[model samples]
Target chain A: MSLIDSISRPRAVRLPRIDGLIQWIVPLAIIAIWQLASVTGFVPTRVLPAPSDVVLSGWKLLLSGELVRNIWVSFWRASIGFLIGGSIGFAFGLANGLSQLSAKLTDTTLQMVRNVPHLALIPLVILWFGIDESAKLFLVALGVFFPIYLNTLHGIRTVDPQLIEMGRIYGMTDGELFRRVIFPGALPSIFVGIRFALGIMWLTLIVAETIAASSGLGYMAMQAREFMLIDVVVLSILIYALLGKLADSASRVLERLTLSWHPAFQKR
Target chain B: MQTALRTALPETELASQANFAPHARVVREERLAQTSGLPLTIRGLRKSFGDNEVLRGIDLHIPAGQFVAIVGKSGCGKSTLLRLIAGLDKIDAGSISFGQDVKPEDIRVMFQEPRLLPWARVLANVEVGLGRDRASQDADARAERALTEVGLADKRHQWPSVLSGGQKQRVALARALVSRPRVLALDEPLGALDALTRISMQRLLERVWRDQGFTAILVTHDVAEAVALADRVLVIEEGRIAHDVVVHAGRPRARGSVELAGLESSILSHLLSADDRT
Candidate 1:
């Protein structure tokens, strides 16, 4: 959490305490104005509740314990889906990248499936998995797979041929060449895929939870919408935005840790 | 260069040796072939990329511990010949033999680009040249000594990206030298450096070759560099050895000395006329 803060307020760009406070002024003012408008009836509470009302509803949910439980459930689903899809995609990428036979066997079919939007398969997914947790997990996994697969393949393929040649001339076996040279060379591209997969992971989870999920942020939003509890719905959206930002920041930290030797990531 | 020889011999011998200094260096080189470097012989070597024959019917023999420089026009097959000698590429016909069994680590090539693994630090990059022995106990010490030889020991912990162009090339040299190769094939290794850096690097190359006694095969376009450092300069034209020039310049020949300048001009003219023909 502190690392994420440091990235947002980088030491090079961050100013003194007074200026640091100034960075938050615009958002605070917007919230204040929003509260004023709700009190003065400029906007109907039914359509869009005030930020304070959303906070109150969030507090109520926290006391009742649904907020923590639902958040955990959503986080768990995304983690499991991301892991399953990311690993399989990486395996396929290594297979195709290293072996011409594997590429010729599976590349055409993968490209064909990649053309069909994964979200479009939601109806068929529902029919196949019957609108349960499996349906949501499958959708999330399918949505995240293609980006990781394509990027990992490209990353491996695009590694500098000269470096590979150097490795060969230095007496590196095929396995050592991949481990010492090719994989590190491909990591920057792989990180790009991870970030893309994260986006798709969240998008899939959002849609998946709405399909009869008994627990999760998306299900909470759906239940609140039916009851016209606008504040709860707004709170759930805010929570998602926060979670997505956190996930992205976490990945960026991982990227920096792994690729610090890269020119772009090295400390100034 | 003179101080060591002068101290080793008496002042009377030094004065008498001035006239035959070049031959004295040659005699010393003959002694350097005690078994460190392997002598190479090639017979009717031929290589082609499709229909365009790169090296046609090449025949040559190089003694162990001899510093040879090959000069040519861009497509004159000097690099192709070097690649064949190093076994980086296959020959279409004929043979290149080291005259003995040579291990995988016995021959190494340093290309124009540093080709250091950017993901690896300077020391790790140098360690790569040790072949299968990179995991041995003495690998780190050997790599460090090679870096110290190239005068970049201070930069061993840094990434290759952070080094200057000349420094990166030095690191590459260290990597090539760490393996203690019997044959070192240099494919225009200093072609990208600035003039001053190139000259300094040349001096370093000469010093290391003298100390380690590797069979150095340098492929370069600079005739001045060829004459100053090499015992023999081979000019390639029409995919064959067009001129075999022997330089008798003594150790540490002064830049632009009369003897070296004459050899450089003659080789440059050969290269330019080859260009004119094309």
Candidate 2:
């Protein structure tokens, strides 16, 4: 008999999935009330436009292709910045975590640099790159770097020593030990870093875009604010919320895929 | 603590700790059955962590396929000796030579913790034991054979996290066995297991030892467990083997039998009396 068949799968109780819309009730009600109030002029339109007005602004931007372009720009900035910063941080973490000499050489300097608020350097960053793409990239990368680096380093350091000893005793080579034991052991913590960095990634992009930029969602919002297009401004805020949620969900999906064996992830 | 364990309960009480059939098919391979164990020659083995000497000149010889157990109080350096023997800790002032020029996989250690990789499925965790041969064509077959030997063939696809504590330790045993190790150093492997699980594991350990004929060196705190499994029991006091007791009993010795219990009682009393003296 195939052993795989005997694993006794936990069948989650199924419901027809109009069941999912139960969670949407409050949000829909709020949206309805806000739209009603906005249309009847219960609240001044200039201060906070109706949800429909914001949706109209989004439609206008979408038809003109401005929405897609800005979304693409923001996505590109966030991802590229994440990749560059994340890789560098990962490399440094590996080097430092695995070697006393490397740790001694650079960890103190990195820690000192980490203490200074990354956003506080926005003024100097603007002066350095002057509204160019590099300023935003720099800010985003810098914002993304510390969390990943710290988490990666902490992850590597806290990996169970007994497991390492067992690996060596079982005849694992240095590379094999790292691949089969060290990396997997540190992965949960590393994922923590990824989730944290993703948040920082968008936060940095939004701030950088809003402060100085020719393109991106932040620039779009900034332009709307200048022209007092409150509906567009509100739409940008909603879009930022959506973007943040989207990014977090993507990381969560990746986390679930890799860490399916983790106890916390073993449930339905 | 010693007094409580010294008092042997009824045989049925001891027998209730059985998680497996009394005679499970543990002997998977008979190709090279009897002479698989490597003889160990440890000469004046000394180990110290800085100024504190853990093992002070431990000179001992273990014959091929001998089941030896070392027992001692908390600070008596039993684990230090085992670590030195396993080559996990460096000897400060001596040599430990094996009967043959052994490769890394020839010797294996099973620690108290199962140490199964949580990221790996049960089968992959067992495959980790094949060492350099883990990538070979027959590695999966060998691991499957080992898992079968431990009666855990069916749980191979499950995650390590899902397995019960006893089952996890059994998987660790399968991993250690997958290497076809000539020497298996068990550092209180059953220490973390519950009483029922511990007894079941003890039997599994003995069956595998008899089947594969590996040099088994178990370091433990449980006197009854040591008496139950090991052919020879060595009690350490002040980093030295104070008593080298041999159990002159036949195979498949009954659990909680008077003979075994008497020996366990005497050893525990001696250990306790010594503790009081210190």
Clash totals for all candidate models = 0, 0
Candidate 1's DockQ? 0.72
Supply the TM-score for candidate 2: 0.89
Could you tell me the lDDT of residue B224 within candidate 2?
Answer: 93
Which residue segments of model 2 deviate by more than 4 Å? A1-23, B1-33
lDDT of 1 by residue, A61-115 (tens): 9999999999999999999899999998999998998899999999999999989
Alpha-carbon local distance difference test for all models:
0.86, 0.84
- Superposition error at A160 for model 1 (Å): 0.5
Instruction: Say what the interface RMSD of candidate 2 is.
Output: 1.0
Candidate 2's displacement at residue B27, Å, is: 22
* Docking outcome class, model 2: medium
RMSD of 1: 6.8
- Across B152-203, the per-residue lDDT of candidate 2 in tens digits comes to 9999999998899999999999999998899999999999989999999999
DockQ score, prediction 2: 0.66
